[model samples]
Target: MISNLNEPDFIFLLKSGDTSAYQQLITVYKKTVYNTCLNLLQNSEDAEDICQEVFVTVFQSIHQFKGESKLTTWVYRIAVTKSLDYVRMKKRKKRFGFMRSIFSEESNEPIYDRPNFIHPGVLLENKERTEILFRAIDQLPENQKTAFVLNKLEQLSYVEVAEVMEVTVSSVESLLFRAKQNLKKILGDYYKENEK
Candidate 1:
């Protein structure tokens, strides 16, 4: 019954467990959250899993939202945090697996497994370039990567990114600047190596 309400009202309904409110919230945010997860994790399955976790966390913790930022900003923050957590956990597992393989007699694990991610919306003509770009983005430092994803890929404003990241607008600007510089160096090195 809460169709056209503002965010505060929508949140009120959600906190009270209104079914429509929950539906509306998911309908409005599912793709954004999923994309955020996918861009960070670079794997659809992990993204989907983390997307569900983000929603669950949101539902469970709605009462903790202090209204300091826009509802969407808070949601984005949750999505980013969950996605990064998944990435960190995956890296830990990979490192542990590597160590175990070193000690095992018959271990045949690959040295590195890069994620094969093609954003569903990318044009066919740009798939190769997109893949390269994604790989470069993946190599970025975590903060720079998060800022880049939210600003460049998700098209959020610097102010909005700062809100989501809980940083100042200037910090967001700096992160984006560093992300771009790093991406250029990465892509340049890749192309140079390939041209050899």
Candidate 2:
């Protein structure tokens, strides 16, 4: 049903409260959104939760979409923003968790921040290397990390990444360049420290 519909028609159907259209929308984009959230979040449950949140936001905000970008680009933008926001909120909670434990008489166990990252794009045999690469990717500054994830991991074209990131193609290029350089240094230091 959706395959025959053009963008305007699909948007119209979605905005008009067509249930099938909305279902089709989720069917088409769920994996894309889930993978994006997972890569940024590195937690399956959080990714699943945020994937649902992205669709809810899309549903609520479809009217605000002015057709300035492709639907997929807009959806990707929402997913990226939601993922980063989740990460930020988690960081804030972690920062204050110690205080919470102190005041609440909770167990004094050390809070481990890093989850076991398993990128859906990675092969099982390459899990160790993938984890190392992702750890290095996490060390990058936010914009660079986002660009690297969308372009390299998500395989979005530079133009698509630019649209999702709301930046020029040149900016995406610069971010990726700097991201690569930073990743190399980070990974190099990791190996150096572990070479004992």
Candidate 3:
């Protein structure tokens, strides 16, 4: 559907509230957005929810899109922001749960435990290695994690990643460098601990 329309035409139709244009945009971008959310959130359900929310946001905010970046870049930025917001909310909820447990008459143990996150796109042969990599990624600081995921998993170019992250291409490069270094250290520690 989107193949028929050029960027300007699509954006114009989308901004004019054309439902068909919106549907075409969704058909074109749903998988990319969903994958981005899943890699960042590491939870399928949350990723799905965030994916839908990202589209809703794009539809509502189409008028504000300044065309400074490519449409895909803009969409990627929204997906990343929504995913991070979900993670922050989850962290806050966990903290609240811990506080509630401490004051409750019941045992002081926290109730919620995050389930293991296995990305749906991972191949059977690479699952173990990917899981280890994801664990290391989960430990990264937020900016490093975003840079790593966008550059490595999503295969976005440095320029595109910079556009999504709202930083310069060199900053994206530095973030990726730091992310890789941190991952190497983390994975090295994990391997040594397991080897012992």
Candidate 4:
């Protein structure tokens, strides 16, 4: 059904409030959007929630989508933006929770608990390594993490990543370079601590 609908037509229908077209769009891009969210978020539940939120946002804002870039690129940009927002919110909540604990009569709880994030698509043998990698990725600055996930995990070209990120390809390259360096340092420290 998606293959039968060309990009321009699909955009037209979506903007005109065609329900079938919207459903088709969701069906066609759901997995890609979900995976993109999951790779950034690590938690399956949060990713799933954000995936729906992305579509809702796009649907509500479809009229604002000028035809400058491919629809997929625009959608990727939305997914990345929404995912980063969610991460920032979580961090803020964690900090707020700590502050509340300091002022409250209740005992202090563990402020940072690493979530058990098992990416559904990962193979059994690679799951452990992937989890460790995700932990390190979570610590990265937002731009580096976004670049790394979109370029390496989602297999998007640097050009595509740049378009989605609204940055130059050189900037994407720099982000990936820094992301790799940071990940190596983080994973190295993690291993050293675990080995002792």
Candidate 5:
């Protein structure tokens, strides 16, 4: 996307072992891929490793791109898989970031300072809800989780997700429905516990 040229040009350059093209491509996509990883891992070091793996896979497989989807989409697909695998393999999965309470009154929060799961102000707020949702999202099945992340959080279109996922639009739709239902069930249970 940074080059604004097309996926074909990137693929050609990448296939010919043009390291510069690979560098440019990484620059274009690193943050989005890293964020996807961080949200999934909730760990900075692991997220960094997953990001590197995604790019390494990209460099190794440019020839396999087949122009099926945008290079960005392919990269994200690799990243999501890597992140999910990283999470499962790590298996620490406990809730984290509790230190965010120290600076709750501060307007700006530190990135590594640990986000609090609760708030002092309004009993209902976005931060707490998002945290709960992300926690449940972490428990989703692989395909459903991947679909939700790429299509919903990343804002990719269904057609784009379909190409990256190597499935039809209808399948993406079906996965999303199941994903939503599963998430709703999980979060509903969470809220119910809160009511107790």
Candidate 6:
């Protein structure tokens, strides 16, 4: 479908409206797309939907491909935009019922996996604390949280992140610096309070 797809083949296929080539594109990049969406949304269903939408958008816009960047980078830029927009929309929806929302619900996380050396019981004991940490991450301003996750968890280079985030490399560095500082303060306070 994509023929060679090392670079030139992809440009030709995409520009020629070869739908089969799009299928190959999705197959090759599906896991990365799904996982990146999951990292942003924190919900499986949302991630799945967003991944599908991303592929659709990419295919529809393929004719506009200007070769300004590599295909992968172009697709990733779309993924980042869709994901950030989803977060903002969700934030707006939650703003009205925000307080009751937090106190009235129990988290629905199941299927915990632990290290082999650790007992299941011990793992459960730590699970709530881990949930708290994730909640703190969720509470972070979205941009800072995005930087932290992409840089720390996904291991993207600052330059790669800059392209995805549509910013300069120095801006990415500053964003991550502030994110790290804020996370340390928030997480450290949580631990100190628990210790006391």
lDDT of 1: 0.90
- Provide the overall lDDT of each model, using Cα atoms, as 2-decimal numbers: 0.90, 0.91, 0.92, 0.91, 0.76, 0.74
How does candidate 2 fare on TM-score?
Answer: 0.93
Candidate 3 residue pairs in backbone clash:
none
lDDT by residue (tens digit), candidate 5, 39-68 = 666667777888999889889888787875
Winner of 4 and 6 under TM-score: 4
TM-scores vs. true structure, each candidate? 0.94, 0.93, 0.94, 0.94, 0.74, 0.78
lDDT of 3 at 29: 99
Off by over 4 Å in 4: 108-114
Error of 4 at 135 (Å): 0.4
| Model 6 spans > 4 angstroms off | 1-3, 97-130
The candidate with the higher lDDT, 4 or 5, is: 4
Instruction: Report the Cα lDDT for residue 178, model 3.
Output: 95
Model 3 misplacement above 4 A: 108-110
lDDT, candidate 4, 28-59, per-residue tens: 89999999999988888899999999999999
- Model 2 over residues 1-196: C-alpha lDDT tens digits? 3588999999998899889989999999999999999888888899999999999999999999999999999999999999999999988888787677777775676764867686766788998999889888888898999999999889999999999999999999999999999999999999999999
Model 6 lDDT, residue 82, Cα: 92
lDDT of 6 at 143: 76
As a whole number from 0 to 100, the lDDT of residue 107 in candidate 1 is: 90
CA shift at 158, candidate 2, in angstroms? 1.0
Against the hidden true structure, what lDDT does model 2 obtain? Answer: 0.91
Residue 96's lDDT within candidate 2 is 82
Cα lDDT for residue 42, candidate 3: 91
